[model samples]
Target: MAHFDSNFIMSRILLTDEPTQIGCVYLEAGGIIGFHQALSAQLLLVVHGPASVRCDSESEVCVSVGDAVFWEKGEWHETKTETGLMAIVIESEALNPTKYMPVKLIKD
Candidate 1:
């Protein structure tokens, strides 16, 4: 519970035993993070701007602020943007977003 006047919110805890890393990435206009296989399970959370992401041979998907993309270990993926963007990336062998995040269904 949060106090009405506190302006503070608590987040659910995530536990991991394997090595974990978190990073903030910025992409300029026309920037791209080329395709590569994920070394571990990974999650990319967009915090600003918009970008496109692709996994394996799948078509690119546009993502904007507040969108999140996850990739399993060994999955090939790529990220790019035309108008720049900023995102938080989390990597770990033990990452499991399904435990804390609701699945977002996409129709082909």
Candidate 2:
């Protein structure tokens, strides 16, 4: 957790395994997580008040409690909030080929 001012605090929790990852981030009002890209398919869940997101190929979107967003692997995205925001983030697969076996599309 980090305290930025009298009214703002940021916190995060993260976990991962070979196939997936789960994380939660708490961002206070006006806080930003910055522009970035996901290495694998991702699911972002907004579990608290208003947050906004910007992703490549789309316009910015405002999200609230119970809202969810999905991002394809390697898609650039960013997140911010004008009010306190709690987001649950999940990513699927290892992403890095060096870390896992090759995927087989079919069985002979």
Task: Estimate the TM-score of every prediction.
Answer: 0.89, 0.66
lDDT (10s digit) by residue, model 2, range 1-108? 346546764332223466787799899999998888888877777888898888875667777896766677888999899878998887886433223223222112
After superposition, the stretches of candidate 1 with alpha carbons farther than 4 Å from their true spots are 8-13, 105-107
* lDDT per residue as tens, model 1, 7-105: 666544257887899999999999999999999999998999999999988888999998889999999999999999999999998889888887784
Clashes of each: 0, 0
Worst 10 residues of 2 by lDDT: 99-108
TM-score of 2: 0.66
- Each candidate: RMSD: 2.0, 12.7
lDDT against the true structure, per candidate, is 0.89, 0.72
Q: How many backbone clashes does candidate 2 have?
A: 0
